[model samples]
Target: MRVVGNYRNPGPQDEYSQGQGGYPPVSQPAPVRTEVNAGRLWAGGVAAAVVAALIGLVGVLVARAVFQLSPKSSSAFGDDATVQLCVVAALAALMATGIAHLLLVSTPSPLSYFGWIVGLLTVAAVVVPFLGSGSLVVRLSEAVIHLVIGIAIGGLVSNAAGSASRLTLGENR
Candidate 1:
């Protein structure tokens, strides 16, 4: 008998052949299962919120110091635009994280769907300011700031989803 890989070539007089000259079949491995780590996902969401707040703060600072621009005050947002922007940005980040989590569990291509949703939202944020009553420069500044915040939140949440996911072969189906 000769051994090759996992199969053996039985000789003509081999007793194990029992009138059948065939090798035993090899079994296939089980499929891999993927699971999400909620803790890591939330941690990334918190980090994304912090980043969004910082971006908001910097955006306001640059607009004020560099361009000598002042935030327009309205009854809806009150006098402190910086505070509002920061808080809104933080909340937006958290919301984005939730959306990412939902898509991760429900959608087939979660990342792709998340990207499209975020991109569309970012576009809406940028466009909404232009439609409102405000100076071109102020609107442009606000739009730019919103654009940056949206991008940061999206990227962070996506990365978190990827990191939080675990793959195991034949562990849990």
Candidate 2:
């Protein structure tokens, strides 16, 4: 037969470059931008605050009605335990929302970091009443309130963050 080196004529396929198609071309998708809608986030924060306050109020009612725990006078927030817990829950939710926003803008894994921070803060809140000289029922009630507020803020804020996100491909929506 013919010698291998003697076939000097190059075919069309042989002349084709790397990008020419025997195989399909590899194309990378355009980069997308993800941004948080601040207004939506703020609205979500307000809703979370209200919900937290309501949850605290419910806790106060349960403590009084079911457990028969009288509201203890606090040097900090005065005598109305329901009002005090409600205010604390609202403030905590607002603070958590702000922290979540900051984390979302700055971190790659925002919710993960947010959960850790909130969890630690909640633990501190729960432990603070125990460190003070309060009746056992009062301390337990306070701790339970703290736990509920923490859960409300953590869950709601995280969901809000997800809902507030907007995705865009380059300059196009």
Candidate 3:
């Protein structure tokens, strides 16, 4: 007979090492899966839209009442320029949400990509008014409004994407 110790070497056929009614076998951990919750993301998108519209309204009001500035009469939106601005701001928020969702689904480090894209777009919006044939004050006011709307869209949607994603371990059984 051989002396037995509390700890024994586990051979290839050992039942405990094989997880046979004993200690489970050591194995690599399951990979994690990141799942996006669409409902939450869309809800955040809607909130962003409302915020953008409100920003547009307030920006226009401030420019008109406080600074006595207004969009050019020959603008594409014509006489209803304020109303058009609000609508466009809301639409831009929604579009940003769409881009965020798309990136979350298809890319790695999606928020980084989304930030860069939205930032560039915002800069473009801020610059376009200056390029047009408008007075300095009016163009500056328009650029400011666009900047605010872009910032609101980018920030709100990025927060939404973060809150809507969850990580789960892949099935291991």
Candidate 4:
């Protein structure tokens, strides 16, 4: 109905002139996205721990099978094999956890990273006492070592959750 150029839309010229909103206004740039929630971090850490534990169990089964094919005697099971398997399993678990920390974490806060490293190492410490088959007291000491290491790892993991926090200790508020 009016004199116009050969075009259906105003094209790049309109875009250039009126800006995106069809008017010139002092534009506020978009805000940067920071780390949001701790849930993922905590869950991921726990998952790492659980997966490591499962692998350890698998090592136990493998050890039992390799050593005790046909049980001739109740105590015929080689303690050395059991100890090796547990130690190997602990190492494997911690190694996998370090990998998890490197891979799974989206936001790498220093505390989070430190906790991850230490927590994984604690799993390794859990197996130190099983280096050689020994007396019952020594074995019990090994377990005590494992327990202390586990508790320490748990504490370190708690620190991991402190980073990337969107929630508080107990409640969402």
On lDDT, the candidate that comes out on top is 3
Indicate the worst ten consecutive residues by lDDT in candidate 1: 70-79
RMSD of each: 5.3, 8.1, 6.8, 12.7
Error of 2 at 162 (Å): 1.1
lDDT of 1 by residue, 119-158 (tens): 9999999898899997898899999999999999889999
How do these models rank on lDDT, best leading?
3, 1, 2, 4
Q: Candidate 2: where is the Cα deviation over 4 Å?
A: 1-33, 71-78, 167-173
Report clash pairs, candidate 4. none
- lDDT (10s digit) by residue, model 4, range 51-82: 44544445444444644333344343334544
Report the lDDT of model 4 for residue 173: 23
Q: Global lDDT for candidate 2?
A: 0.79
Query: Candidate 2, TM-score vs. the true structure?
Result: 0.72
| Candidates' C-alpha lDDT | 0.84, 0.79, 0.85, 0.48
Ranking of candidates on TM-score, top first: 3, 1, 2, 4
Which candidate should be chosen as best, given TM-score against the real structure?
3
In candidate 3 the C-alpha lDDT for residue 25 amounts to 39
Off by over 4 Å in 1: 1-33, 71-79, 169-173
Checking candidate 2 for backbone clashes, the offending pairs are none
User: What is the TM-score of each predicted model, taking all chains together?
Assistant: 0.74, 0.72, 0.76, 0.32
